[model samples]
Target: MASQPADVDPAEFNSLNEDFYRADPAETIEHRLWMLAAFLADESTNVGGQEELSLSRDEAPYRKDRVQFAALESTLILHQAAETLLRLCLAHWTDAPCPWFEMAKLRQPRVFPKKVAHVSNTLDTDETISELLRIVSWSGDQDVIEAGVKWGYENGWERHREGLRELIRYCCVVIRDGADLYNAGKHGLAILPSEKGVSIGEGDVISVRGPSLTVIERQVQDGDLRWAKVTHWVKYKESIAITGKIASAVRSLWECGKTAGLVVAT
Candidate 1:
């Protein structure tokens, strides 16, 4: 016969029950943004480490591969974060109840940009930009303000709102460009490192180069063909740089939203 387990303490059990009940299990857009912020914050450390590795002279095996992987992962996170931020903005601006689950179902590349463009056309005027800047300035974060201003200046945008619109547009582009890669990564798509050779007719090679990583997909239209399609390619360092810009954009929008009372503190 098995020995009986020791009895649990009633007081301890009661305390645990009380704690569980006190915790809020409900999810909200604010909570989702907070979670994404936390994820990006964690990935920032990884990005820094990858940057260091890329600059180092160490000849470790697969060192380049590691950097490339970091870039891919960071870009995916940035795409998701940007999508969520845009959804939150749309919800607030339109006074519609755009919940997280509903937004998650959106075909980001196809649907999000059109909606954002419509809203911007109607509301992103110079006056509104001025109002947004005033609200952002109230946050007292010089870095956030300067980031948007600097980006605007670099793009030759005269108005701050133009810069803001550009930033959002860039995010949409990232989502569109990365859609195949993102879906591949999420859905067990086969990826590999590969190179393409450039040569003359008689095999006189000019050069050979390709993306650091490539995603492989079945050629649905030509299933009878022997070769699979190289659907997407990622230039590792360039992708990493793009991820940095996305992060900065997300931070600026978050700060602006918080200051404007669009986002609540979690």
Candidate 2:
């Protein structure tokens, strides 16, 4: 690392320190991986199911409503991560390029019941932790590595803004049990399988699909999927404002995206 010249203005050093922390979450690879892992754990959450009746009440046995079970069920795959034996279930929708986005779906440090997927480092703890340490050390370079990290924070945020919001909303579902309107609505019970696969993207509202009706953030399921949250159509109406804001952000993002040659055709 090059030391600053004594003649250099001290203000330059102070300004750099101020902006760097603001960029820390993005610039630091460790933090990015940490956030990504957090997001993965978030979206991977599924609250209620038939056999899992922790949320049901005595008087209202076999309750079909889901709102009551706000506490809901939570299953973390393992005490270990990446190396543990667990099925790597890539959240897939169709047999299309949508498969690529799997990389961005951040997950947690959890080991599933079986080992279904593996990254080069995941199989070995020594290498994985060592590589992370290397990156941390690399960040000390300031010019070469730090600049690239800062660029990632700036660019990844700009590139995946809407995509990230969709991720964030799902995150809300995991962290805030009450906010999981889909899983926490009504009795938060089961009738049909909430096979309702919701794959929200940059310019889309999360739509929960069922055989009979496809609802956005609210719907009951019928199939092998699992139990679903009931929708209070009236209360959910207010979410339109939030929905609208997401749409607008996606639109602005798309418009700007074209300049960077990455526009998604809605």
Task: Give the TM-score comparing model 2 with the true structure, all chains together.
Answer: 0.21
For each candidate, C-alpha RMSD in Å?
13.1, 21.9
lDDT for model 2: 0.29
Give one digit per residue, the lDDT tens place, for model 1 in 1-266. 67644544543433433332232222233354344344434522234445556755433325444454544565465566556556645543422222232344344446666775554554456554443344323322345556655552453434544556566666666655666667766677455544444556566655445544467554455547444556344454455455455455545544444445332333
- Per-model CA lDDT versus the true structure: 0.48, 0.29
- Per-residue lDDT, model 1, residue 263, is 29
Inter-residue clash pairs, candidate 1: none
Predicted structure with the largest TM-score when compared to the true one:
1
Q: What TM-score would each prediction reach against the true structure?
A: 0.49, 0.21
- Candidate 1 — which residues are off by over 4 angstroms? 1-61, 95-162, 195-210, 216-228, 262-266
Residue 74, candidate 1: alpha-carbon lDDT: 50
